[model samples]
Target: MLGEFDVGGQQALLDAHALVIGLGGLGSPVALYLAAAGVGELTLVDHDTVDLTNLQRQIVHDHASLDRPKVESAAARINALNPDTRVTTITGRLEGSELDEAVAAADVVLDGTDNFASRYAINAAGIAAKTPLVSGAAIRLEGQVTVIDPRREDAPCYRCLYGDAGDEALNCAENGVAAPLVGIVGSVQAMEAMKIIADVGETLAGYVLYLDAKRMEWRKLKLNRDPDWPPRGGGGGPGAGLGGAGRGWIELDKYNRVKKPKHPWV
Candidate 1:
């Protein structure tokens, strides 16, 4: 099993707690893989119900689970896969203190959510909790995955990448998504989380992975902390920026920070 790869890694995964937000397309594969891999505890949060359309990409739910709350559907599937994994389900959207409490209780948080507002909220909570975040997104045959570790001084949080970009809702309901694209992104997210928790392999703390499914190509981009971004663990307070960079006002460098792919296939 996992012990052959990393000594005592199986027990390490069994001792970890993970909090997952959203149980849709990306979440489906993330939750399934984590449970199958022996994560000790899981906190699942999702407000939506299983709809007929979700079956296209949400593999955790089936026709039997139609109209059921997504958390319940996902929990059932997880239990069926691994009864040893304990699951705590929250069936509604979490905000404010609730989100903070959940993030604080977990060793790692995974964001399978679809919108910017939810991502921003999760980022703020992860920063306050000093927890690592594994984030994934998929829509219209494209996907992206990134790991945000607030504990790292140079690692960029989600806000640093999309400052002031109001939540422009883009989802599979409105934009068509490839059936297997979410699986690819979500599986990658789960793998990153496992590596972080087990303290094995090189984590993607400062890199964002971009997937172009249509062309079957992948790109990796380096991320930088926004100079004006609030200090980590400061609870949104102002402090000396990373590298002692002045913080009156700084322009976001997301557009210029992305490194073009040298080789199309990796």
Candidate 2:
């Protein structure tokens, strides 16, 4: 497949490390595909355990895996699928130095997390580490996916599109996502991550793909970087201007420093 696709620019997929920051719906497909595609290392992070509710969209977990840590279930499935891939499981929510350290060690990061706070934290880590991020989200009939590359000065980061508004996030638990919505978005995220690792084709670094499953329509929108947003590892300080809205600029470590509302969804 690599030879036919001319992927990785002579860099083998067997040497790449990918960090997936959730093991729920979106993370399920991303993890499975990356492992199947022969990514050498996968660092799976999630604080939640599998529930019967997650079986609707989270294909990585099954009846026997109920009540198990999502990372454990995901790792088991990945191992069963591809023994060549090494899986590292972090069983809890990663924050502070732990999150940054994981991102720093990875060749790429995939944001399958549900909330804005986690997304912001992951984006910050990716920027600081100069790693590419494949971000995906799904709620109800709507889904969106984008690629954020901190190495590209002109590319818009995740925060550039959605500021630090954790409270505003509508998760599947609340909004009730369609079963296949996450599958579609997560598959796209995996494709994007593989493209980045393989050095093949154009990535969605500056654009967001929106999927409206109800209407079965798709739209792509170009995103612009927020000028007031601080550079990678640059201090933005609390309350710094963030884009057009009155949203305050939160620092990279905001997730660790602040106490946030506990959302039920992963």
Candidate 3:
């Protein structure tokens, strides 16, 4: 399996560093594939515990992981799949200085988080560290993926994309999601992460890809940087208040309109 990928670049990933912010649906596959791809170091941060419902899409956990910290469950799976990759588990929420420290050491940060608050923190940290971020989300049969490079002047940061965090958001518990949707997007995240580290292929830095399982259709949207967006600071600037200002952040309600066009996807 490893041979099919760039073998010469294996060391790049093996020596490369990554951080996954959540261990739920999308996080599971993203972490698993990166580990399997031999990413040298991976840090997983999540405060949630595993529940039976997670098994539907969070394939990293099994019957044994129920009631266990999600980070531990994911770490064990990654280490078992690829002993070469170093796995670190942060068994709680990452915020403020701690979140900054975790993201500062990574070459890429995967936005597997489900909420806006965490997403905003990851975005600020990635921008501060000038690291690339691979963001993915899946709800129902739909998924989206985008890459944000804060170091690049033309590419927008996460906050530039979303307007704000506190308007109204759906927790996964309230909103339903499809089982395989996250899998598909998360695997794509792993691929995009490798390409970014290797400096190969067309990365999803300036575009967003949306997938609909019910229709089995895919759509690519062009994203342009918002010139008026403010830098990372929790203030009242055009972009300051928004969650993922420069990076590609989705407005769930807006997305649902185009992604579902009928019933709610999530």
Off by over 4 Å in 1: 2-7, 167-169, 231-266
Candidate 2 displacement at residue 10 in angstroms: 8.3
Q: Cα lDDT of all candidates, in order?
A: 0.78, 0.78, 0.75
Query: What is the C-alpha lDDT profile of model 2 across 1-266, one tens digit per residue?
Result: 45634555425578899999999889999999999888899999998899999999999999999999999999999999999899999988788888889999999999888776677778888898899999988877778888989899877777666555445334567658788888999999999998898788899987777787889999886666766766643334233223333443342222112223474323
Please write out the lDDT profile of model 1 over residues 1-266, one tens digit for every residue.
55544657888899999999989888999999999999999999998899999998899999999999999999999999999999999988788888899999999999987765677778888988899999887777778888999888777877655554432345566666788998999999999999988988888887778788879999886666766555542233222222233331122222112211222110
Error of 3 at 48 (Å): 1.0
Best by TM-score: 3
Global Cα lDDT for candidate 2: 0.78
lDDT of 3 at 53: 91
Per residue, candidate 3 scores C-alpha lDDT tens digits across 93-116 of 666788788888899999887766
Report the error of model 2 at residue 222, Å: 0.3
How displaced is residue 125 in candidate 1, in Å?
A: 0.4
Clashing pairs counted in every model: 0, 2, 17
